[model samples]
Structures are given as structure tokens and as C-alpha cells.
Target: MRLYIAIPCVLLALVFAASGIAGITRGWVLPENRHRVRRLRLYGWGQLVAAVALCRQMLFSTVLSDPDTLDPHIREWGILSGGALLLTGIILMGVSQRARGARQGTGTP
Candidate 1:
């Protein structure tokens, strides 16, 4: 269904964004291109968050409709996996913000 396309899209995006960040950190990027890279990272993160939310919502709807039919282990795994992904994405945003702040020379206490 929609997930067949959505999941891979998100995974591919995340991989691409992570690699882009690595490239930037290693000075592969030009000084003037910093803002563009930051924007791309934010867009990638938003896509990832939306995809996770969509998955969690789908699982919730499915589980509630046939709670007894689906395996309990699956329900547990889905909840855990979705939650972890959401949290990780949020934390990555925080790290990204810190990096941006440092670049602006306003990150120090």
C-alpha cells in the first residue's frame, strides 16, 4: 500500500541526510552552502517525523480494530519501534540546533 512507498522514501531520506551531514563535517561542503545544507537537513527530519507518525497512527488504528486477532508481540514491537524512531528524530533535531548555534557563535553557556 502507501507504506510500500513511504517507508523506503523516509529511510532513503534519512540515509541521505546523515551522509550529507558527514560530508559537511569533513569539510566536503563549501562555506557559502551552509544554509542550503541546514535547510536540507531540516526537511529530511520533517519527512522522517511525518513518516513515523503515519506509521504509528496506522498501527494504532489496525490494532484497535482487531486487538485479539493481531499478535501481542507485534503490537509491543510496533509501539516500541515507533516511539524510538520519534525520540531519535527529535534528539537529532536538538543536536542539529546545537550545531547551528555553535556555528553562529551563540551556543556557549
Candidate 2:
């Protein structure tokens, strides 16, 4: 049960990071185009949320903690997911900015 939850959580994080990269690559061709990026961005963020929730579940699945002290595996998973979320968020933000600039006809980097 715990392993199952952990697997999806980490996968989601990786997916988030991968989606962000895809969005950036797509954005490069047409900076103003936001349709694909918007959809992918939502997926990425959703994955991050799911990852956190799933990871929390894995951590507390057995001897559920009230305060949720960090178990070693939980700590590592959390850090990985958090980093992926942060990186994806940053990439999405940059893409959004570029989209805005392109829409404004500025084409700012």
C-alpha cells in the first residue's frame, strides 16, 4: 500500500518536471501560443498536489502520526517532489511571462 502510493507520488513529480520542459520547448516555437502550455501546466500542478497528498498518505499509512514526523523515505520523497514542483512552477511562470510578452507584441525573453 505504502509503496504503491509512493510510486505514483514520485512519478507525478517527474511528470511535472517533464511537462514543464515540454511546455518550454513548445513555447520556444510560438511564444504567444498558450493553449498547450496552459493544459500541460494544469496537469503538472495537479500532479504536484496529488504527489504531496499521496506521499503524506504513505508516511502515515501504518502508524499514522499526529504531527507527522519525517521518516527517512518520506523525507526523501518529499524533497524530490517539492523540488520538482518548484522547478515546474518556475518554468511555467517563465512561459507565462513570455506568452504575455508575445501577446503584447514585445517578444521579451
Candidate 3:
């Protein structure tokens, strides 16, 4: 069960990190607000960091322990923190995409 959850999280983390890197290097920007590029880059950085933290908590921390033997507190903290970061990364990415689309007149809100 944990493996199932971890697999998807790892994949998302990779994607977030990759997209963030591309945004940072390529300077993804909106036409309506050139100054907003800085905010977008910051969002990218946030997503990248959140993704890394999520992956670490979900994959590395959980992998070594037997489910039965794992401490509840550790498991709770890992899941809580990982989930929070994952949610944050997803939200940031979504906001960036929407901002881009809105600027491009793609009807995104």
C-alpha cells in the first residue's frame, strides 16, 4: 500500500522538479506581466523544493521500516509533511499554469 502511494509521489516529484528546472532555466513568463516572471520562477522553486521534500519523506523514510515495526509518530509525520508538500507543489504548478494561460488568452481561470 505504501509502495503504491510512494510510486506515484515519486513520479510527480520528478515531473515537478523537471518542470521547475525548465521554468527556471528557460525563464517562462507571461506576456501580460513580464515582472510576474520572477513570481513564476519563485513558484517553480517552491514546487521543486516541495517535491524534493515530499519524495524524501514518502520514499526514503518509509522504505526502510517494516510496517508493523514502524513508529506511528514517524509514519504520521512523514505522511502529513509529505502530503502537505505535495499539495503545495501541485497548487503552485496549477497557479502558474493558469496564470500563463490567462495571459495567453486561453480562457483559463
Candidate 4:
């Protein structure tokens, strides 16, 4: 059961980190409009960091004991912190996007 859950968590962490790095490097993270998007890079980096932390927690828990029945505290903290970080990164991205949109719509540049 734990293995099943851990597998998906790790996969998601990898995807998040990869996508975040791609977004930062490719410069396609923002909208098509060339308006000011504050903290876009920060959000991307945050996602990457969050993904790393998540993976670390999962790995640590797995190493501490049998993957099938790891420590509940570790699992709980990992899931909670990881989910919060993901949400925070996404919210930052959204805020940046909204800023860009506002600038574009208002012709503020």
C-alpha cells in the first residue's frame, strides 16, 4: 500500500520538477502577451525545490523502514508539506499570470 502511494508521489515530484525547470528555461511559462509577470521564475524554482523536498521525505521514509509500512509521521508530514508546497507554487504562478493579464488588458506593459 505504501509502495503504491510512494511510487505515484515520486513520479509526480519528478514531473513537477521537470516541468518547472522547463517552464523557467523555455520562457513559455507566462501567457502569450508580453506583459510584466512578477516572480515567474521564483514560482518555477519553488516548484522544483518543493519537488526535491517531497522526494527527499519519501526517500527518507522508505529508508527508515519497510516500504510497505513506513512511519506514519513521516508519511503524514511528507504528504502535507509536499501538497502545501505544490499549492504554494501553483498559486504563485497563478498570481504572476494574473499580473501579466492585468498588464496586458490595461496596456500597462
Clashes by residue pair, model 2: none
Give per-residue CA lDDT, model 1, range 57-109, as digits (tens): 45544433366766777776776777777677666544544445445566778
Clashes of 4: 0
Per-residue lDDT over 2-107 for candidate 3, one digit per residue giving the tens place of the 0 to 100 score = 6877788789878868867866777654355454444677666666877787786776465645768667787777767877776777677556655433465768
TM-score of 4: 0.52
**1-103, model 2: which lDDT tens digit per residue?**
3465566655775664455455444433234444444454444444344445444444544233333565667666655675565566555454544433335
lDDT tens per residue, model 4, 49-107: 77877786676555445556666787677667766766776666666555443543755
Model 4, runs deviating above 4 Å = 30-37, 66-109
Off by over 4 Å in 3: 1-5, 29-38, 60-65, 90-109
Better of 2 and 4 by TM-score: 4
How many clashes does each candidate structure show, in the order listed?
Answer: 0, 0, 0, 0
Task: Return the number of clashes found in candidate 2.
Answer: 0
User: What 10-residue stretch in candidate 3 is worst by lDDT?
Assistant: 29-38
Model 3 pairs in collision:
none
Q: Judging by TM-score, tell me the better candidate of 2 and 3.
A: 3
Task: Give the clashing residue pairs of candidate 1, or none.
Answer: none
Instruction: Tell me model 2's lDDT, rounded to 2 decimals.
Output: 0.50
